[model samples]
Target: MALLDTLHRWAGGFVGLVLALLGLTGAILVHRDAWIMLPHAGDAQIQSTHVLAATTERLMSNPETRPQSVTFANANLGLDRLDFGKGAGAYTEQAGTIVSQWQTQWARPELWLFDLHHHLLSGDTGETIIGIAGVAGLFFVITGTILWWRTRKTFAFRPLPKRLSRPAIVRHHRDLGIVAAPLLVLSLLTGATLVFRPISAVFLGPGAPATIDTALQAPKGPKVALADHLDWRRMIVTARARFPDAELRSLSLPRKESGLVTIRMKRPQEWLPNGRTTLWFAADDGRLIGARDAASLSNVVAAYNILYPLHAAKVGGLGYRLVMTLSGLTLGLLGTLSVWSFWFKRPRPVKVRRGVRP
Candidate 1:
């Protein structure tokens, strides 16, 4: 019992700030589509696949700013996204004119918060640290629940403690931590697994491949110049013909001279809104060169895919978003209060009956 108490306090005290930051950032990200507020160009009336393809191809024609990828605007959102490079993205109308630039966190709070949450402002190294923090968060949750079990009879849900005293705060921390343990564990475990993908194999099964790395290389064909007009309509038609049941989602144009055009799609049965299935086309002639179907994924890989949407609450619309939001808030509050209780608050000494004793 003492060991559990010491472990919980030390872990919470050391990583509480990071966990709180992650929770706060995650809460903000849950409503990203609503808050970013990228100006919509009014919905396009024409919804032809060919027109959509043409719009994207036209956008890539610009030599000064070649896009790395282009995400089509949702009918409701009214603008597509053009990613020029890392940390550089712009919203555009169906015609592909710039509506807004969201390369920096200051300009786009959601994107900045997203990078901070996922990458910790330090790229892969930071992600590894955040991943470790997530594991630590899981530890806290498990240990906290065990500790709370000892005083389960006294559990009471309260918005805040009855008083500003140390004892009052401790009670709030204990009760709230216990209440939020399950959710915190889920969020932390999922988020951590995403960062450290290798951890996924443990749950997936021993020896399961944790990643699938595919790249588009230069094919044996006449090299196409950037100025050469691309048959945009043909590419879309080819992709549809190949995957009739899949919904077209986004397209990534090759950044390098030998790069291939990659398309992302969502099948009907997929839980992820963006879809994991991908197809690559030769940039020179729009020939289908490579493909990965969601339906054909292995059990381990398929199981791993579910974790992302689950952690992000991307499946159940607004209701699930609210649940995730509450979970995040609970974690932030629990971590903050626990840290305060452990480090800052001092135990109050009992008053003596001075009138009789001295």
Candidate 2:
């Protein structure tokens, strides 16, 4: 028991700051759609297939201004985003009018904040560190709950420490941790599982990872570069005809040696902000190579798809956003104070006089 308590304290001290930053950033990111203010940004989402196809065709036909990827607008935010890689991007309206553009991610707070929360601004290395922190955070929550069992009777509810002293902070930390344990578990588990896929086996059972990977992997196509003026309209029309109820979510060009143009769509029933329903088209002629319906995914894979929406508060509307906001704020408080109590509030050794008695 004592060893568990010590481990929890030390682990929290080590990763508390990182967790705090993630929590604060995550809280801010949950309301991203509401905060990105622009002309027609709040306009109603266009549902017409003709309009969508026309707009996509117009934007992609221009090679000089074409982007590597396009994330179309949804019901919440009505401006499509174009990614030109290496931090350059722009936002456009449904009618294919560019509303804003930036040469670097730093030009937009949303882009950088997202990068920070997901990658800590250090790319893949930062993402690995975040995954490690999430694992440590999960340990803290579980062990902290067990340690709290001893003093459960003395539990008192306080959102913040009554004073900045060590005893007060320790008491507040213990009680607050218990209060937020469930939410912390949810957030930390989902985040860690996302970065470290093997962890999913615990919840999803063995073979789940392989099943998900095989199910979502894109099909191989002929080795041919994307056409200079590919039939974007034809591709959109084909995808719409197949998934009549799905909304077009994103379009991504082939990467590296792959010659497949991928189109992602969101069905009304899907929880993922960008649904897993996908279509792969031959880049050379824009012919449909294959399509995958999100609904037909294996039960295990379908269950795994819900993790992102749960973690990001994407499905439950404003109420869930507020719930996750509270979770983030609670985690922030717990992490910040845990670090403070562990390092700054430690007891100081007493000084002895030059001529000590005895």
Candidate 3:
């Protein structure tokens, strides 16, 4: 118990507070896409890539706007983000550029929610601080697990005591911590992985015939325009034929001046938001290039790769979302309880009336 108290005291602080906030925000971020205001989902038959290409070309011609990116959804729906001027951008889903923009801020409700998680919208400082907090939280959770081990048999869900006393603080501290410990461990460990990629990369190496080291080394194909050799339409046709039930997922326009265009698959029966199989194509002449299969990855690496999508509840749909949301609230409760326990332990000034005896 003495040892547990020491560890707990060291673990709870401002860094813990930041981590608590980051975790709370992170949980909400998991289902953000479903909640954030965006244009409606698209139809079954999305338009051809070439058609979007024409619109992109026209949008580019206007000097008033410079295309930052053009994303394909489907025939009736798509998203275009443009650099109108400065750091500003507009989102256009329907054909012909409509000026719909969101200000980049920390307090814009949903965007603020995002800011609270990533940057506190404080830019790099907040990001770095949050990253450090995640590390602290990892330490806290691990230490907590060790502490809980001592009280394992006696553990049961119990609320804090009504009175302010040493025993009351102890009960509140122990019981609440025990109840939320499992989720704390999960949320913190995953949160830590998101902040520290190297940690994740290392964890991804344990259970495989070959390490994630091999997976990360996937060939950096010589620079070539992926669009040139592949036809986006034909690639789509082949992909649809291959995974007929799959919906049109996000597309990655060719990155290499000489690389291929990439498209992902989202299946109807599956909860995977983005297909793991990326179909690569020649960007210039539109030819089927290659399909990179994630399933082929060693079990070790595949487990590591699931961190983000799982944490964000982006993988398993509503069920996962509910778990994530509840986990987040639990973390928030843990933070408040820890802080409250600390405050309750501190000595308070005794009440004294002017004529009262000492």
Candidate 4:
């Protein structure tokens, strides 16, 4: 009991602030479409690859730039994104006209928030720290629930106390922790699994991970025409014929001569918007070289795939999004209050009787 109590405080105190920040940022990110404002605004339609091919050729033909990837717009955001090398990109309309020049990820608020949430703007080290915090979050959820059981009889739930007294703060922490325990655990588990990708292989299988470039290879033959010159229309047509019912999610243009143009699609019954069903084409002639269907995925891999949509709330629509938002807010508040109660807030002073006591 003593060890658990000590660990509970330690986890919430040492890493509480970081966890809270993540939670708040995560809540904001869930509604990323609403917050981000793309400079180019147009009703460009992309029912076929003909329009995309024309647009892609125009961008690739530019001597000053090279196409790296082209992400098609979904229902939420109606702006096609074309990324060249680092710090270079552009947004285009369906008609293939440039709406705005690409800005650095930092310049885009959504991307900025994204970097902060995922890496704390500190790269690999930050990601590791965030992963650790996820583990700590799980610890808090488990230990808090266990400790709550002892005080279950006196439990009184409240959003917050009217006073800043120690008892009131503790009450709020205990009650809120209990209320948000289940959701918090689920979120932390999924997030941790993502951070430590190897965990998927441990529980699922080696093929369960969504790692890209499994089939990538060095260019063997003589160089062909630039990737932009390839028949993108045919590539799209082939992809559609291959997975007739799948919806095109995004496309990754070849970055190098040997690189493949990878297409990710969301098929029916898949939870993720960018379903794991994937196809790779040769950059030269748009020849089909690699392919993987979500339906044919191994049971372990398929089970592992569920974590992404579950953690990100990609499929449950608005209702699930709202639930995730609430989860984040509760996590943020719980962490913030726990820290305050431990370090900043002082214990209530004991009352003294009149001089008769002395």
Clashes of each: 0, 0, 25, 1
lDDT tens per residue, model 1, 174-225: 8987877778878999999888776766676655543432111233433454
Query: What is the C-alpha lDDT profile of model 4 across 1-358, one tens digit per residue?
Result: 9999888886787788988998988888888865556554434445565665565566555545755777776666677777765657777775556777755876667676878888998889999999989988988888889999999998888887657876788888988889989899878888988898765665566655544223222234324444446767677778888988887777776655555778888788788767888888876777888777888865665666788788877768889989999988888988888888878885667788888673
Candidate 3: which stretches are off by over 4 Å? 1-4, 37-99, 103-108, 119-132, 148-170, 201-204, 207-210, 213-245, 254-260, 267-272, 282-289, 340-345, 348-358
On residues 93-149, what C-alpha lDDT tens digit does candidate 2 reach at each position? 999899999999999999999999999999999999999999999999889989999
What is the C-alpha local distance difference test score of each model? 0.76, 0.93, 0.59, 0.75
lDDT of 3 by residue, 170-243 (tens): 56556666667676667766666766566665555433424555663434443664322233345557766666
Output candidate 2 Cα RMSD: 1.4
Q: Looking at candidate 1, what is the lDDT of residue 31?
A: 77
The TM-score that candidate 3 achieves is 0.69
Work out the TM-score per prediction: 0.87, 0.97, 0.69, 0.85
Judging by TM-score against the true structure, name the best candidate: 2
